[model samples]
Target: MTSPITTSSLPEELAPVPATAAPAHAVALVAEVQPFPIAVAGAELEQLAHRLIATRWPHRETAADQGPALDEIRALCDHWATDYDWRRAERFINETGSYRTEIDGMGVHFLHARSPEPDAMPLLLCHGWPGSILEFRHLVGPLTDPVAHGGRAEDAFDVVVPSMPGFGFSDQPVTTGWGASRVADAWIELMRRLGYHDWVAQGGDWGSSVVDAISRRNPAGLRGIHTNLPLVFPTEAEVRDATPDEQRMIAAAQRYRATLDGYAREQATRPQTIGYSLADSPAGLAAWIYTLFQDVTDSGGRPETVIDRDEILDDIMMYWLPNTGASSARLYWEAERDVSGAQVIGAVPAANPVPAGFSIFPGEAVQASRRWVERRYTTVLHYRQHERGGHFAALEQPAALTDDIRTTFRALR
Candidate 1:
């Protein structure tokens, strides 16, 4: 058998594209139109709400709590249609130094907040499924000016929060292979386009996967990587010697796959089929994503237990206004071939030899073990387990999440 590759001697197959191969001409950055007014008039919101209240829901079987729980759906719809304010959420995003630029033939929207510190570390942040650029809104002020938030200026970072292609203001790419690997390349190009050479990358969920791909490729001038979710598939030995807690966690994961993996299966296999429902009916869209927010988290109560109504609606609204349900879901459709094939290799084995850090939140799909993670990462500087947050760490625990980024990159600095 081939000996395991050392970090130093890892083959060039894992290396990033040569600098000469990178774009030579400074890509002309095209500015996007400033986003429209965020505040929906109270009367307009009321009218939409009234429509939801009077909505004609479809008939279902008596045993069909298998779908979104009716009570939960009704409660969420009521809050969204009546209580949620898009304008407030919009104003918050706008105030955070948001901007847009065209990259790889798509209009890429992002929030670029420079730290108050003159020598602040540059950081690229990404969000995942059922989320928008809005997820990172709370972390911007704290990250860019840590002193104001009762932290050291030395902990400050110049943060870049980009909406992934096919989501939010970013133009949907009409091509194949926009998976984590492709997005990682886009992010590297995005950083270079902004004239930054060295920077840190961070993400969770799909964002986590992209950053992982980016780090694995060891793109030039990349300082390190940080993620809320780590893809740590267990090895044969680890599985054989699993402890009860590990075993229990594995069982929970299996149960989640059985019940919750349907959406992924559909998105991966035939996103367009369900895309029609999501694109057309506001109620249908809400139910599709609302189930994940409810089931994926360890929230003591409902989604409101973790995310505010307006916040939740704001994320959903990104899909609504753009009608990106089909395009966004197509990401899974594109990735389906890999997920279904046994020939697929685990992401860690394919990892680039960069330093990595993790912040594990509750109710995530896979809570990887440190031992498992260390096998892939050359440097595992920080791994913290938080009691309060769930899968949507950026949204649910921005302060804690921001602190994690500050702490992780401190080692690199």
Candidate 2:
């Protein structure tokens, strides 16, 4: 079985978010949205393969159950170098009709797929750390055209999947303050610019936090939110008189904080420090990210049980090809600083005022009981507990996640 892992102990500023403000140097509302396609240079792919071949691995984990085993990593690396077809992944992304637009001075890259149905609800999907837009790749065609995927046309959506700033192809912020709150504002502006006056929002991991921020703002056009990673922590009262489920979750959260969160601490405290290794070594980047995938997927022991090795590499290619190791990690640094207070060991932020829905998968890094989630999601339209899936819910269980989106939003709509 995979080792147990926990969510990042990354700090959040307890201070209330201020009213959304446009950056002083914000681009005008009429900023351009240009068509963009994925095209990594030939030499870069060659260089990556060479690096994989030249890798010098660390000694095997003394605790066999701890982190990725040495042999496992070597096999993965071998597959990456010899059999992974990044070109196929590139074709998949390009076919999605991606685009880049300037929002509040930062260039935001997004995939905009309109439904064949005349009247489809507009939905925005956000991804988090170690994840690129590729996380939601499988859900796009299914979400945008449900009819073709064995669903009714009425369930169709005009989907918008944006790469978070500093992640994927989006322009990385040179200065600070691109935290959760700022990203929430940027997403609102993005939807507005695209002429979506009313829409729904969804995310997992850091994306859940971003969507939570959006729900808090209760923006004009945001209809509701559906999050897979429901960041809900029990109150003091709930803790004192915990249910069996709550006690189990509380213990798990504690174990995660104590044992499996080193990467988060490093990233939050000093992204640039680790960025060096992540940037210079493809194998290092793969190993770092692979650890999380291995520990967090619903797969019994191996990540490949749920996701294809090539698909996993495709997600990594977003970081390797763009050389976004430093930039992407900067997001944690910015977030930790922006949300200044020390993160309470096992606490969810305050309840969101807007309508919300949560899907808690079995293998999530952080687990929460329904009563705990209901406290924060005051208007919880839906709350589900699944037997499978994990932090990468969209990628691991696309149909389940997509169905939740459809079911949750259908009520709100």
Q: Which number leads on lDDT? A: 2
Writing each residue's lDDT as its tens digit, candidate 1 over 268-340 gives: 8888899998877788899898877877776843777888777888888778765678888887766654342
Give candidate 2's total backbone clashes. Answer: 4
Model 1, runs deviating above 4 Å: 1-51, 59-65, 337-351
Output the worst ten-in-a-row residue range by lDDT, candidate 2. 2-11
Q: What is the TM-score of each candidate against the true structure?
A: 0.85, 0.90
Task: Encode model 2's per-residue lDDT on 169-283: one tens digit a residue.
Answer: 7776778888888998889988998889989999998898888788778889889999998777776778898998788878877776887788889898889999999989988
> Each candidate's root-mean-square deviation in Å?
10.3, 9.3
What is the Å distance of residue 167 in model 1 from its true position? 0.3
lDDT of 2 at 211: 89
> lDDT for model 1, on a 0 to 1 scale?
0.73
